[model samples]
Target: MRGIVLFFCSLSLVACQDPAPPPVEGTVKYTNAQWWLDGDFAAGERCAQDGLLVACPAEPSLTIDLEGGFVIPGLAEAHNHNIDNNFGFTRMNPEYLKRGIYYVKNPNSVASDYQYVEEDIARPQTIDAIFSMGGVTIAGGHPEKLYVEFLSQMPAYMGRDFDSLNSDAFHLIATEADIAPTLDLLQEQGAQFVKTYLLFSEEFERRRDDEAFYGAKGLSPALHLALTQAAQARGLRVSAHVETAADFAAAVASGVDEINHLPGYFVRDVATTEEAEAKYLIPEDMANLAAEKNIAVVTTTIISTNFYQDNPEQLEMVKAMQVRNITALKEAGVFLAIGSDNYMSTAAAEAQHLVDIGALEAHEVLDFWIRSARRVIFPARKIDCLQPGCEASFVAVSEDPRLALPLPETITYRLKQGYELN
Candidate 1:
């Protein structure tokens, strides 16, 4: 009877594959394939398994044809609003998930823009539909866009203009009482991290101007502390838009896990501020604070390239600042992650920008990019490299991203969850 029971269990195991075994897309091992699994420095070396270029020594076999090209981990967007980005027209299909940018944040769309949050975001089916579009993880929330409707219909209680409204706009964020339930709903819907864009309200701006209430009321550090604690209680992480020095410092004090966007408009490295009113100035000391606390910085340099688009000089300046910060952060031994922050552009462009201006070499950039995404979903393994037992997530760029300018024509072969793209 025991033998019969064992036989039945074995049969059942072979009959079911609910987890969905990974499809064998293809196998690739290249003698000339420049491979970097998230921070490995083995550049210009031959890699193979069983005498092939890149083979799955242990797998339900798949093969890929690199044709003497290069392979690296796929890219990620460290700070992106895919919903807002999808609004404008662009050359490429912005939502193409194959490039292995399988992660996104705040997928707001035209529907979400027009619909009330309570109606649109409060339902599980609606949230699941948004997630099913192929973002494995997303930043949980979105702040109001600078829409004319929001501007024209600014609440009577709120003040006028972008500055006045944004300064004290903690009201925009669901309060501590609301955050817990909202986060609970998000977790049920598979959200990985909570995100909020920083925009101040008129009251906040006014208080900022006044000495007595430099950081009080809705803009108080306590609010962030509350938010962070709430997220922590539920094992969620927080990512915030820290565009200015004051915002960056406040975010750090509140213990936000990661910072999106590069730190510009802040004091230069190893420099002191002479300005009497340094409200938004991020001193060098803040960098030290971030480093000591083990906060990862996502370098969205490529996104900034698109910014100041009309102003060539300003664009160039932002790029220069990125280069400097990348170097500074690396030297400081801070973990760096690469995010495209791109909307409606080819992955080639995003990857190329990182190689072109950032401090990382081609292979290192690939590792940084993937590691960021892995962190987005699973922060525990902060430094996930291409090692045994790791999830197979990589990309095959037609050429070495470090040396060659990623031509729009060059194809990027994406591999995620052990399945290669068709």
Candidate 2:
């Protein structure tokens, strides 16, 4: 009887010590919660809240206390000009980098693009290595057609063409046919998504057709369509550099998923000719269309004001348009992703600028930024917010992000998949 009683006691002890059930399998909760989620409330309900993440009810994970600080998604710069930001073009002088700007998006400030390539692309591996190291994902631009233009701009570096440079340094698909080839290369190289060059207005496209622009190397909408179709076939969405409304319209009409910048500049007629063209501002109709279609817009609102002075007029325009555009989309149920087009050292500064310029409410900008990044980086995956069965991605910042704080500093404390990087 004593032996049996002892055996029963041992069994009960073993049952009680079952190791807390493995932490509810993938859950992280904010200790001092004051974060408000805006996009897709259903999605937010799954992962974001003040209490313990219900999914992992039994987990003993780290508690990130923001001291009632604001929590939002990690920001993404969807329409960023890659070559310019990482290659030391914006702040440095490279003659070759400048020449390429006429044809390609120049990241260096130089006279000849050939020299730019020599100085920058000579160490191709170094270029992409920086992006990988940034703890951020990017949509890289192709460097082929622009290379031809670079050659024309600088005959000295012409001998060492784009193909001669390390293709590994950048993803260089120039045409529709190049899509599959590029995808294969990226898959082998482990790229997240593909980026395209400037969108041409129907008028500009016609002009190019007349000149057979870029020596007949310029990509047409048809080619773009083909590339998008191929990329989507391989589960990739193309991000095009759109400047005007026509470009935006064409991108939407082509059935691409997202527009890299705001469509305000694109939809207007900046033609120098006296001709009757259809006027298309950021029309309420188009906003509705975007919402109904569920097409995502990455409003790099902060960067848009970078070129134009943030005067009262521009600020008011940004404010009204942002409010109307965002409100319209929200009313129509459009998904908006926020990004700072200029991914400079002052990244967070740019976010503050967005609020200052009235592009978004102080409280709501973070969610928009995160959603934008998630949409472009992972168009297919439903992984924007923290939720059960969702990829764990969130940020913890002190105080509510929506309210304006003096010289605000946001500290990002988390990354996707639950790695505490505070």
Per-model TM against the reference: 0.62, 0.59
- Candidate 2, residues 214-268, lDDT tens digits: the string is 3222245666667667766886555665554556566665566666666453223
Error of 2 at 398 (Å): 2.9
Positional deviation of residue 177's Cα in model 2 after best superposition, in angstroms:
5.2
| Top candidate by TM-score | 1
Ten residues in a row with the worst lDDT in model 2?
Answer: 128-137
Instruction: Give the best candidate by lDDT.
Output: 1
Predict model 2's lDDT versus the native.
Answer: 0.43
TM-score (C-alpha) between model 2 and the true structure: 0.59
- Alpha carbon lDDT of residue 54, candidate 1? 42
lDDT for each candidate structure: 0.46, 0.43
